[model samples]
Target: MTLKEATLVTGGSSGIGRAICTMLLEAGRTVVNLDYVLPQWSHPNLVNFQADLTDAAQTRERAQEIVSQYAITALVNNAGATRPGTIDTATIDDLDYVVALHLQASLILIQACLPALRACGNGRIVNMSSRAALGKPERVVYSATKAGLVGMTRTLAMELGGDGITVNAIGPGPIATELFRKSNPDGAPRTQKIIDSIIVKRLGTPEDVARATLFFLSPENSFITGQVLYVCGGVTLGTATL
Candidate 1:
């Protein structure tokens, strides 16, 4: 009998991660979420593992266990938090913690899942990078880590291509998730400027990013890898539509 294939997602308790989990589950794929936070919703097809991904040892343990219990065909590294600070204010501690949660945790998860992903055939891996990766003010560390994820995505795509595992990244811009709003409040001038810069003249939604992720995971998208898809209302174009 064929075993059911599943997608493993980190930080799936809220915002973009939650949206990805919802979309994957709706696609008839089983989903396992690794997050220390409990989500507000649930489905029979969705399984939650309350593991803090920042903890490397625990991350490896849970990732291995999940792969052993399920055919993990896809992995979405969507767990990241920002520590906003200018050059003067950014502390070494900020760098350390974000690195643990962002870069190191992803590395650990990927390493743990490599064997199962190789065995699964046609496996997919999506890293949730941000336009901040290109460069964002007061977000030096966040930018660096997200940029690193992009670099890792490129390298892994080539290294794992022969294994039929595709790796890519989604770089979202000014998404209106809880995380985004924490810094860019609605009706604020800064927020307005961000909207105006978007060619779509609007902030991106979690669903928009989720759809891009699904596109990358699609069987028809087999030829696409080592690439970053920017789901940012065309903000990357550098001019607003209005």
Candidate 2:
């Protein structure tokens, strides 16, 4: 079946990015997966583009390729990297890589896609951030970059609202995925402790953040923009029940 709209998701080959792509595919949208790695899922309606998003020229070229070839009405900037560190131990290379991947690449892609999005008439942008931005010291670089993402979301909203575009962000906390497990080696024990701290009592799934993201990306969400809708399962509510 042909879809009325097409959505492009960066880093769509794995983890949260994969889940977002899957959700869009399930909703019957023509989806494009732009990443260096190919995801395990296959569908006739899905198009995969392999590229390093951190390379500005490559991102620009790929963006044009996607827009010229597909009807892209939505973009989900879900590509990013994370590293654990404190001010002292984090190297210059670490900061540069993190910022380039998490911030610069996202901006480059968005800039490249803006024209297509504006032409689509009802474009939507979803920037993937992290709940760690709220109050996490261990992840100073990651959190700061995510906080910058939120800033970009708001600014884009302001600039794009006049052109029928809505920009919003999603901050997910402690999601259960291969990357999460990889980040925390003692996955079960560490995850259990995290769950204990939450009201939900379970580590968040990729689907959780995907669902929250879909809502903002929905054609029905015209009224919302520049807002950080968190899918932390009450984690954002503070020392509340969760």
Candidate 3:
């Protein structure tokens, strides 16, 4: 019997990541959720593997185990953390933590998954970036790591194109999730300002981001690569009151 080729997604236990996992399962794809926490939702195709991505040793060990056990055809580097602080207040520890999770972990996982991805012939890789990668206040460290992902995505697309693997990124803007609400708080002036700035006049949902991700990962999207699709409601264009 042939085993189903799986998509490995980091941080798939909650918020945008959880939404992605749900959508993939609905699309008849086997999904392996590599996260520290287990998701609340359950599906026969969804498998959860708990690992701290920030730890290099743990990441390598888990990535090897997952890739060896599963025929991983796609990888989504979606795990992230936000430390909101100005450059003056941001410490080395903050920089280290964000870089470790966002940048280093991705590098490790991609390396581990390279052989399987190559064997798949038509592989997909989607990196989870943020609109803040363009520029955002009080998120110097976070923004830097996300921007770095954009660079990595483009470079990998070029390097892996001959192998029939496409690398892309999704940069979500002002999505209303538990994490967003926790960071921005309800009724905060800054939050309202952000909502008003969006041309759609509201925040984006996790499903919105998930849909875009699936598009990039679809087998039909073989021509597209190294592109960053901003899942914002026209907010990236400019802040406008409507």
Candidate 4:
């Protein structure tokens, strides 16, 4: 099938990334998923491109190849991993890996996609950050990398605004996904504490984040840029006692 403009989403095989891909497809947009594995579902508008995002060289090469073949108008840097460790325990290797996946790869992909995005003249970029970036224990490296995305998003928004491109970020909190379950195992006291802390009294879903992401990527949101939207069920407002 032929498509005029396509959105490239990293880590689109699972979790929030998968939800974003599904939403974009439902909206009739061409989607190219860049992930280590193919998505569980398929659509005529969706194409899966496998790439190891932690490897900047591979990400750059693959991004170039994809943009060369498709008219890419949007990019979602949603690929991430949680390496839990405190400053006292975190190792250099841990920081490097997280930075590679979350920061370096995003820079490479953005550079590679610049031409195609510029051609669209109304390109959009949404970076996936996290509430951890604001401050969270046992997540020094992960938080650092995610926070870096916020700065990157803002800088890119300013730099690319002249081209009609908007750059923003989404910070999701306590989402009920396979990754969240793995990281915050069910029935754990810590998990219950987290659940009780949410003002909504519930964990968020991938669709919750997908909806926020789509809002930033929407053409009508041309005026919103360099902003971070937290889809955390009001968790960012601090723990509620109710």
Candidate 5:
């Protein structure tokens, strides 16, 4: 079947990416997901492709193929990993690995999608950064790379505005996803600390980030670009300690 235009979301097998895919699918948009692991659920409008975005060549190849096949109108660079370590424990390998997936792969996908995005005359790009970007201990490499995304978002917004593309970054703060649960757990001292630190006295949700993403992806927000929306329940107002 000839597919209609679609929105491409990376790391959609779970967490915030999955939430974004859910919202887009409910809106009747075809969705393409690229992740190393397949999502647990299925939908007629949702398609999955297994991709290890850390592999630069594989990332570019799949991106080209998907953008060509899907007529991609929007791109969401949401796949990321955190290599937790204090400055003394941080390693060169960790820096390279996180940078490869978070920064390099995001650029590759955006480049591959540019042709199709520009052709559509109204494209959307949402980069999933983190509140950790502000300054999170034990996440030196992750912080550097996520902050790199914010720089990329602002620059691309300027470069792609003429193409009718709006670029934005979402800085998620303490979302209670599967991964967060595994590390923080319920009633854990650290998790409770995070909740208390937030002005809203709660952790953010994947749905919160997804909603902000949808706002950026909407044609109605065409005039809003190069912005960073922190769905962190005001965690950003304090130190980004995690």
Candidate 6:
């Protein structure tokens, strides 16, 4: 297998998505970053496609463009937006945007890229999920959308399995990113609490989530599909504190 095999990742401009893009590029893969914002980096193998993922037409067009321009073998749905607040306070527009970006966009892109993915033997698909989907009730809309991603992963795995494509998801817990800090003003303390409760007493880094994503997308991960692997420091073990 050559490094020219392309991996397309949405939300590659920043946060965990950026980390995932860098890792895949470093591993000698052609990386296509689909996002509304562009990253401050330059690489011949890194292809940037600026598109409003929430817009179905834009997503479909870009998906086609990526396949036409590269030998695409993987798709990573990581682009998402959040309007943090309780359901009562969350606006209709906010909820709509969340669903559009997190749920609808992924579905549209996968459908648009199916033919290309099927053509590339051993193709892979990964959805970036959240630990909040487990039991957290704070961001109800966000959690619901992420949980929907898990369902998409499983269904796609079944549908695309016969075509030699694998689908899986990764959930990150309390990652120390700028977004995380802004989302929780006292995030540091909260992160610390989560760390102390985890088997590994440290907040996870963007790289940690990226690495797990890479593992699932690797050629060796052919047998692993429909699995939501949480890259948190033992959060799934009931070790994490809210």
All candidates: TM-score? 0.94, 0.92, 0.95, 0.94, 0.96, 0.90
Local accuracy of candidate 2 as per-residue lDDT tens digits, 128-232? 998877867778888888989989999999999998999999999888889888756555777678888776777788999999999999888899999997778
Query: Which of candidates 2 and 3 reaches a greater lDDT?
Result: 3
Local accuracy of candidate 6 as per-residue lDDT tens digits, 42-91: 68779898999888888888877777677677889999766677867777
Over 1-242, each residue of candidate 1 has an lDDT whose tens digit, in order, gives 45567888999999999999999989998999999888989999999888887778888888778877877788999988888898899999999988888889888888878877888788899999988887888999899989899999999999999999999999998899998898899999999998998888999999999999999988678899999988888766753122
Candidate number achieving the greatest TM-score relative to the actual structure = 5
Candidate 3: C-alpha RMSD to true structure equals 2.7
lDDT of 2 at 77: 92
Q: What lDDT would candidate 5 get against the real structure?
A: 0.92
For 44-118, candidate 4 gives per-residue lDDT tens digits of: 989899989888788888988897788889999999998899999999999999999999999998988888788
> How would you encode candidate 3's per-residue C-alpha lDDT over 40-77 as one tens digit per residue?
87899898999999999999999988977888899999
The C-alpha lDDT values of all candidates are 0.88, 0.84, 0.92, 0.91, 0.92, 0.83
After TM-score superposition, the amount by which residue 67's alpha carbon in candidate 6 deviates from its true location, in angstroms, is: 2.2
Q: How well does candidate 4 match the true structure, expressed as C-alpha RMSD?
A: 2.9
Better of 1 and 6 by lDDT: 1
Give the distance in Å from residue 33's predicted Cα in candidate 1 to where it truly belongs: 0.7
Whichever of 3 and 4 has more lDDT, that candidate is: 3
The residue pairs that clash in candidate 6, if any, are none
Candidate order, TM-score descending: 5, 3, 4, 1, 2, 6
Weakest 10 consecutive residues, lDDT, candidate 5?
A: 233-242
- Candidate 4 error regions (>4 Å): 1-3, 185-188, 238-242
Q: What residue runs in model 3 are displaced by over 4 Å at the alpha carbon?
A: 1-3, 185-188, 238-242
- What is the total number of backbone clashes in candidate 4? 0
TM accuracy, model 6: 0.90
If both were scored by TM-score, which would come out higher, candidate 3 or candidate 4?
3
Off by over 4 Å in 2: 1-5, 185-187, 239-242
